[model samples]
Target chain A: MRFYAVAVYGFLYLPIAIIALFSFSAGRSASSMDGFSTGWYVRALSNPFVMEALWTSLKVAFFSAVLATVSGTMAALALTGMKGRLRAIFDVLVMIAVMIPGVVIGIAALIALATAFSAINPWLEVVLGRQLSMGLGTLIGLHGMFTMSLVVLLVRGRLETFDRAQIEASNDLGASPLGTFLQVTLPQIAPAILAGFLLAFTFSFDDFIMAFFVAGSETTLPIYIFSSIRRGVTPEINAIGTMVMVASLTLLIIAQILLRTGTLRAKG
Target chain B: MAITQARARALLLTPAGLWYAALLLFPLAVVLIFSFGERNPIGGYAPGFTLEQYANLPARFAAFRNTLTLAPLGTVAALLIAYPLAYYLAIKVSVRWKTTLLILVIVPFWTSILIRSYAWIYLLGGNGIPALLEAFGLGELRLINTPFAVLVGIVYGYLPLMVFPIYVALEKLDKSLLEAASDLGAPPWRSFLQITLPMSMPGVMTGSMLVFILLTGEFLIPAILGGGKVFFVGNALVDLFLQSRNWAFGSAVAVALIVIMLIVVALYTRAVRRFGVRRDDVGLM
Candidate 1:
């Protein structure tokens, strides 16, 4: 069993390790194992397009994470105080959103946006005084939509394990509902909310399919990577990928550490 | 206080409910409508209600066939690889190493699957693994751009997703049941087969279903590893939307894929339920 576990872990990490190693390799070919240098990373960092895409990805991820966390927390709170079939229905709906493929969601959002805009026949367009189309705004909207379900899942799971007696006691002691929620509930579930935020951010950052549809003319990092790969593989992409991997892993580790500490403190 | 709180709760729900209705439910409604509409000659959706796109579904039969075949194969492959690792982490490994091992399992997930799949592309290419094989005088092996390559990529990409669920289930399992089975004279393997396996079926089902459902719409792996020859319905949808700009046709395919997924998920839940596990046991996120 230990052998199997070790082997599986190796299978999971070996390729990524190789990619990280080769990003610094003097040679570009995967077959070659030359001396390490940070030349590729330097080149990747200096490239204007790579920098632009990175900024765009960060911007999208930040806003999308904030939006998703807010909506998801609210939805979880609403669901928690509900009962019976309505709760079940909402649960199923959220799950369905999570389960649907990114490609389908992307296409559906594009189609819906286009159809609704065109259907207004320039009347509402005149009223609004602008043409609405895909771009950064659409990308953020699509990413938020894609990520909201995941946030709900994570926060809802946390809510399920919550102790309700504390809230009852706080209310009984003459604290108002809002005050009790703010002083008690929010702090208790802060780790879960942060987990949801990190997960949603990572997801939106790495997202390709939905961004492919809604990005319009502006490109995110993943889209840029896709186009670059289509053109040809370069050592620069390996460098970019290495950076992305490091950033994502750092965020993930922080989130996990926070989760562990939160759980431990809760138990205490 | 109760009346005010109820009203406040309703008010709290309004934002998310409105968001879901506008962004999720409304878009899906539009897709359903477009799926029934005709494709305009120029490339977007046209509002003449017709089921011609559905009738022409045979155009993408190849894509559907590939998806249906590969999704299950990928799920089984992932399960076969993940189950033993999960068992080890849950039951055999000491507490000291479990967290480290589980973290290693999930490390790959932090990177984009696209980046991971790209690494597979290089490793399986002519100059990578094949060259290593050639050094041993195994003769030149063509491994890249094959269906097998695609399967390898799928298993590699999805293994963690499969492993974590099974690991959680096994970790939460009652150890006394296994001990009782052992004390009743069942060998370790038999105890695993009888006691451990049945109890973990819910996790197995959940993991497999999750993998299978995602694999059905997989495009990136096939695109990156299969070199664009082996196509799935997801790739077909991508082409229809991005390449062909056939919004109506894409909508039709999207609707079909959704329906098929619904059927598969429904069947899977039924099958898992029939295994006599509780609902919470079977569906772990």
Candidate 2:
């Protein structure tokens, strides 16, 4: 059992270790390990394109995470008050979104966006204006769409264990629906909200496919890394990848810590 | 307390409901509509309705075949490896080390799978692992740009996803059940097969479903590690949408993929539920 455990761990970590090691290797060839230096990191930081892509990725992730969290929290709250078939329907819909391939969603959005355009009917044009082709806005919108389902699933689990009585008490005290939600509900589910936020951010940050379709000329880090790899391996890519790995891992660890501290209580 | 709260709940739900409807449902409806429509000769969609694209689905049969074949094989390989590790983490590890070990399992998940797969490209490339193998008189061996390379990358990329769910399921399992099995004179392996494995079925089902579904649509590992030689439906979709700019055909493919996924998910859910029901019935008997 221990052997198996160690072997699995090795499988998981070895690739990452190799990536990290190669990031610092002085050699340009991905296959050759020619010794280590921090030169790649320096080059990665100094390169204007890499910096721009990094900034773009962070900006996209921030907006996507925020929007996803808000919508996901709303969905979760609605789910808690739902019962029977409605709840079942919502559950299935959320799962379907989760299970649907990113490639399918990306292409569907592109098709839908393109179709909405060029058809000049007033309603069609209005919808097209909203979709308005794939760009940074569309990329963020798609990221939020793909990630909101997971947020709903996670936050809903938190809300399931939430004490309804507290909301009732707040309501009985003459708090408005919005006020009770602001003062009572938000505090209770904040950890799930944070978890949802971080998870969505990580997902959006690492996302490539949907971003690839919608980003137009804007380069998110993953898309940049992807194109770089396609053009053949580079030490600069390793540097960028290493940075992304460190940042994402740090955020994930923090999220796990928050979750384990009982900050986000799982109601179910 | 009840009726007014229900009304408040409905009010709160309005924003999210409208958002989902407008963004998610509406786009999906558009795709469904376009899938049934004719493709304009140049590009995009034509007003006239037809299922010509669906009829042309056989054009990408190779993509579908590759996906179907690889997805299950990847799932099984991941499961075969994940189960024992999960078992060890859940049953054998001391409380002091379990948290650390579990964290280790998840640590890789923090990195982008794209970067991770890229690393595999190099290691399995000409100068990395194969070179090392050749040093020991194994001779020159090509590991990269093959189905086996893709499998290795897939298993590596998805192992944490497979492990965590199963680990959570096993961790939540009651230890006393294993003790009871042992007291009944079942050997360790027998106890595992009879008690442990049966009880962990939920996790197994969930993890396998998660990995299987994702693997079916995977593009990155195949594109990178398989050197674009291993065509998948996902790669086809990417090409149709991004490279070819064929929205109409892409929509058709997307709809087809969704239909296939829905069927698989339905069958899987039914099978799992039946297994659960039968297990419960046996317990009652």
Candidate 3:
């Protein structure tokens, strides 16, 4: 059993380890090691296309995280007071958002947006003298709405065990509702909110499946890498992959810590 | 001026409600509508409604067949491998290392699955494991671009999703029940079968459903690892929309996939409910 456990861990990490190791390979091919050098990493960083995609990814991830955090926090707070079937319907909707395959989401969103664009573009051309298309805004909207479920789940879970005494005490002390919310409720849920935001960012940044369909000539990092990979993975691709992995893993670790600390703080 | 609870709720839920209505519900409705529409001569959708797309479902029967066969195979394979690892982590590992181990299991998942799948291409490619085998005088063997390679990718990619839920379930198990069983002359394996297995069924079911559903729509793994040979509904959808520009047919495929997913989810919910476990206990993350 112990050996099996170790083997599973090895199986999990081996490919990742290979990617990281080969990122520094002096060789051109991804398949073989040709001694160690940081050339690929250097080249990958300096590459114009890689940098643009990375910047685009950073922008998309940041905006989407903010959007998801705010909307999901609000939804979580709102649903806490509700009871019965209405809440159930919303809960199922959230679950379905998470449950539906990314491909299905991508296709559905693509077709729907295309339809909407066709209907709305003629008016936009006459009125605003511009056209609507799938791009960063669409990416942000899709990622934000999809990841809102994560934020809702985390915040709602936190809300369920939240110490209501703090709010009640503040109210009894003649504090205004908004004042009480800012001073009491916000502080209590801040960690969860941060964690949710970080997770949303990580997911958006790492996402390719949904972005693939809707990116519409605007390349995010994963989309860029996917195109590069289709041309066959080189050592440079490995370097870019390594850099992305490091960035996302850091975000994920921070989010995990925040979630744990939030739980502990709630318990205390 | 204090607002009513109803007003506050409305204020809070409005953004999310509108977002879902427009993006989630509306898009899904479009998909349903398109599924019944006809493909234009140049591809994409046409105005006239027809069941021709539905009638054309047999064109991708092989994709559906491969997915149905391999998805369960991958899920069960993942479950089998994940169970022991989750057990070891929950029951055997010391508290000091458990968190580290758990986090390690999740670290790979933070990276783009595309990158991870790319790594497998190197490992399973001819110059990889096969070359090593040839060096050992075991003759040549081909691993890459096969169903086996795709299965390995699925199992490897989804292990953490399978592990964490089962780990949570096992960790939350009342050890006293196992202890009580052991004290009453039941062996460890027997106790596991009678007590732990039933207790962890929810986790097993949750993990299986998650992986199975994802596998049903999985294209990237098969595209990269299966080399486009082991077609899936997801790949078919991708080709239809992006490559062929057949939006109407793609919508039909998407609709069919959704129906299959809904059926699986409904069955899973029924099974979980029959076991008398609260849905909340099945933590996704």
Per TM-score, the best of the predicted structures is: 3
Q: What's the DockQ of model 2?
A: 0.66
Interface quality of candidate 3 as DockQ: 0.81
Misplaced by over 4 Å in model 1 are A28-31, A84-86, B277-285
TM per candidate: 0.95, 0.93, 0.96
- Which residue runs of candidate 2 sit more than 4 Å off their true CA positions? A84-89, A120-131, A169-179, A263-268, B1-7, B281-285
Clashing pairs in 1: none
* Candidate 1 residue-wise lDDT, B1-285, digit = tens: 778867766776676677677777899999898889888789887887888999999999999988899889999999999999998889988999889878888889778988998888678988888989999999999988888898999999999999988998899888987777788898999977766787788789899989999998888889888888888898999899878888888889999999999998999879887776554542341
Which candidate achieves the best lDDT against the true structure? 3
lDDT by residue (B1-285, candidate 2, tens digit) is 688867766776665566566557777888788777776677667766787889999988988998888888999999999988988998889999988998898788678989999988778988789999999998889999988999888888888888888888788777887788788888999978877787788888888988888988898889998887887889988887667766677778888888888788888889898878865753553
Ranking by lDDT: 3, 1, 2
Every candidate's chain B TM-score: 0.93, 0.92, 0.93
A230 in model 2: Cα distance from truth in Å?
Answer: 0.4
Candidate 1 second chain TM: 0.93
Put down candidate 2 lDDT per residue, A1-268, tens digits, no spaces.
Answer: 7777777777787878877888888887665568888998999999999899989999999998998888888878888868878678677778767777887777666666655554445665666544344577887888887778878987887777778898899989999988998999887778778888998999999998878877877999999899899998887788788889999988888777766654435343
